[model samples]
Target: MQNEKDIVIKELNAFLQGQYMGIRAYEHLIAKLEDPEIKKEFQSMQQDHRLHAAMVSERIQTLGGMPVNNEGLTGKIQGFISQMMMPESTENIIKMAIKGEDLYGIQLSEEIVKGDLDPESKNMVESIIDTDRRHLDYLKNLVH
Candidate 1:
């Protein structure tokens, strides 16, 4: 039987992990990209993920739970796979980013709809979701 605080902490930590994954994925993509403008945009999105991670970690600490500092095994595996599978083209990278953002947005939406988060956490997640939608839109535009 998990208490409310514990549940909230778990949710926040999961979100934080996702942010870490985003940061890493962006770094990988940015390193492969050649266009200055595209690289700059990816860097900006990566920074946003960093900010999101910090905010979520702070909230988790406020709830008396330790935030996860790394993206965990799943993230590592995914990163490895991406490194092996990713194409060199800018369009392909952007398309991959779009898929990631879309998936993350769905996950965030599911968390919000679950109604387990405290008001502050829910608000924060909502804000993050909005940023993710923008990121998704930007990536889609770059590929299209």
Candidate 2:
């Protein structure tokens, strides 16, 4: 059974992994999509995820946990899975990314609200979640 500290570490790692996963999705979409404007937009979002990943990594280290590098095996699998179907249109890619961002935002928001994180960590996470919300809103606006 995981204690409070263990749960915190686990959630931190999961958030880190999700950021990596998101970055990979952006990179893949940028490469696969033919539209220049859409690709550029996704590139910007990828940079945001990189920043979030670094912050999460720092928090993991502060908690005396080894941050998983390269986004874990699940991240790798997800990258491969996205590659398998390869969306044909940039619009489709944006829709898929918005869906991912929505899910990611919901997951982290719910976890943070559970009140498991320390005050400082919770504040940091809330900031990151805010960024995700911005990304999702931007993607939706871009597509519509």
Candidate 3:
């Protein structure tokens, strides 16, 4: 059987990866946005994602695991084009990101429960899910 340390390490790595993904998504959105207020919010969200990644990385270190480098490429193309022209693609991209986040949250939660993860690790994942939900609502409000 895997040790508790291993389980926590795995979960922390997963959470860190998720945070990295969020940071990339928000960075893309901010680059595409023109409105000052919306851009500010996106920037703030980006900072939050950085914090989340740091926290998860710390936890992973405590659990004796090497944090995995992110390999995200979801928003690169759309973000670059939107950066040049403030198009109406932000809403769709944000919506798709939210959907992806929700699906990821569900899967992570299930994994936490089923795997040998600790309670603290599970709680951290849930907290990240909550934050993602808030971000989704904020983006949806902007769209509508």
Q: Which has the greatest TM-score?
A: 1
Q: How many clashing pairs per prediction, in order?
A: 0, 0, 0
Model 1 off-target regions past 4 Å?
105-109, 112-115
Which order, best to worst by TM-score? 1, 2, 3
Q: What would the per-residue lDDT of candidate 1 be over residues 1-144, giving only the tens digit for each residue?
A: 999999889888877888898999898999999999999999999999999899999999999999999888998898899889887898898888887788865465556537789988998888888899989888887777
Q: Which 10 consecutive residues of model 3 have the lowest summed lDDT?
A: 71-80
Evaluate model 1: give its lDDT.
0.86
Weakest ten-residue segment in model 2 by summed lDDT: 104-113
What are the lDDT figures for the candidates, one per model? 0.86, 0.81, 0.66
**How well does model 3 score by local distance difference test?**
0.66
Q: Per-residue CA lDDT of candidate 3, range 19-79, in tens?
A: 7766775666666666788778778877877877887777677677888767235434543
TM-score of 1: 0.94
lDDT score, candidate 2, position 70: 75
**List of clashing residue pairs for candidate 3:** none
Candidate 1 clash pair list: none
Better of 1 and 3 by lDDT: 1
Per-model TM-score, in order, reads: 0.94, 0.87, 0.73
Instruction: Give lDDT for model 2.
Output: 0.81
Question: Candidate 1 vs. truth: CA RMSD?
Answer: 1.4
